[model samples]
Target: MKYLVTGTAGFIGFHVALYLLNRGESVVGVDNINDYYDVNLKYQRLAECGIDRGNVSDNKKAVSSKYPEYSFYKMDLADKAVLMDIFEKEKIDVVINLAAQAGVRYSLTNPDAYITANIQSFLNILEACRAYPVKHLVYASSSSVYGANTKMPFSTSDNIDHPVSLYAATKKSNELMAHTYSHLFNIPTTGLRFFTVYGPWGRPDMALFLFIQAIEKGQPIQVFNHGKMKRDFTYIDDIVEGIIRVADRPAKPNPEWTGQDPDPGSSYAPFKVYNIGNSQPVELMDYIGALEKAMGKEAIKNMLPLQPGDVPSTYADVTDLKRDTGYQPQTSVEDGVAKFVAWYKKSYGK
Candidate 1:
């Protein structure tokens, strides 16, 4: 099947595109390649896909140098006209929208970026899907949508009404908007709420990346929540596998749906939400220790309170994911961190 994957330059997107390309599927990739992180890193990822850095500018198609079945374009989802043009040309069968302005702390200062990237961009993708019918649409949501909820092992069945940050609110909004399209247009849509995803080619802004960086430099790592926070850190390969599995099966309506007692996670429409996580919560201190073990360096620590727009813990209940897609995250923190450290050392020639 032909696939259109947005955010192809980003971490998870890069890994997702590679997986699909290796499986002998044609993929059309798009990313604005904004300087949210290192644009050089983004370009390097595209280079691995055989897309020359000089060959791409913006909104222009660049064919892969190695994989003839794969091509990429520099574009933003908020640009509806250009997006529509791609849909017109490619006749995409399935879409995996992973592009977003991702950061919880950054959202506090730049709320507009969140709205523009998360809300407006997602709306355009939904509308484009309506204009060009596809078999399925799998979009990236976040575990942050579970904000302000103290529930252990966050289940999709739980109502996430109190979002602590604008970022979380935007993700929750995507799920709502997707449900609307699914109900009205009969579009099969699945929202995968990713939990603390990290691995090789992972974003530099994430905790694992940060901790590793500081420890390597012999700098003091800022331990948030005084090292009390817990996160369900799933490996990149596991996350990509879950996405493919969930996307292959277009969402279906729950047969036993009732309006009087509706489920937030599912509706009578072809819409569903699932948490794709390791289902294993690790403490911040333990995670840091794992990094130190892998790096063979001790990190100077500075304790800090839990900042606003932050949750103390996150543990995903991926029961539905396993039941529906046979997904089981296999990477442990030690193994995952070791791989990441190895990649970091090689990628930087450290």
Candidate 2:
């Protein structure tokens, strides 16, 4: 079966595409290649996937030299016409929509980006799926949607009506939009609420990447919430595994679902949401300690108050995901940090 994996230039998207290709699955990847962080890193990721930077342009297909079954297109999902062309041409069986305007802090200053990249793009994707039906549509949501809920181990069933940041709000909107599509169009949609994912080839904007880069350079690392912040620091491999597993299982209506008492996670329609996290929250300081141990360098620290649109902690309850997909996140902070550091050193020659 052919899969269309959006956000191929991003960390998770790149990893997912490569994993599918390695397994001999036909995969088509698309990304706007936006310069949210560093376009070079994005290009490098594409190059690693055997799509030459020079060969990529808008709405053009660049087949991978490394993997025969893999192809990539540099395109924005907001462009419905071009996106529809892809859906019509490729006969995409499944779609893993990972593209979005990522970053809680960035969303604060640039709310329009969130609207364009996250909301508009997602709507176009849904429209394309509606026009050309797919067996499954798995997309990325975030634990950030558990905003202001002091509840430990955030569950899928919890009410996510409040989102602290525009980024989180957009993710919540995606879930709502997906549910509507599932209801109206009979689409099978599954949303995965990813926690703090980190590992090799991770996004430079992420805490893990920033902390490690600063420590390696002997610079001060910003400790948000004055080191009180905690995250379910899930490994990239674990996340990719969960995505594949969930994608393989098309969502089915919850037989026990009732409108009298609605479930936010599942519905009578073919729609489901699951949290894919490590289920272990690690303190910010402890995560830094792991980075230090891996890099053999101490980081100068800068204690900072909790920034706006930031949560003090995030813990995921993966019971539903485990029950449904047999998904188990296996990497601890230490091992994941070590793997990232090793990759950073090799990639950057640090």
lDDT of 1 by residue, 122-218 (tens): 9999999999999999999999999899979899999899999999999999999999999999999999999998989889988878888887788
List clashing residue pairs in candidate 2: none
Question: TM-score per candidate, in order?
Answer: 0.99, 0.99
Tell me how candidate 2 scores on lDDT: 0.94
lDDT of model 2 at position 40: 98
Ten-residue stretch with the least lDDT total in model 2: 209-218
Q: Mind giving the per-residue lDDT tens digits that candidate 2 earns over 1-350?
A: 99999999999999999999888899999999998989999999999989999889888999988888888899999999999999999999999999999999999899999999999999999999999999999999999999988888899989988889999999999999999999999999999999999999899998888888787678899998899999999999999999999999999999999999999999999999999999999999999999899988899999999999999999999998899889988888899999999999999998
List where candidate 1 sits over 4 angstroms from the true fold. none
Model 1, C-alpha of 221: deviation from truth (Å): 0.5
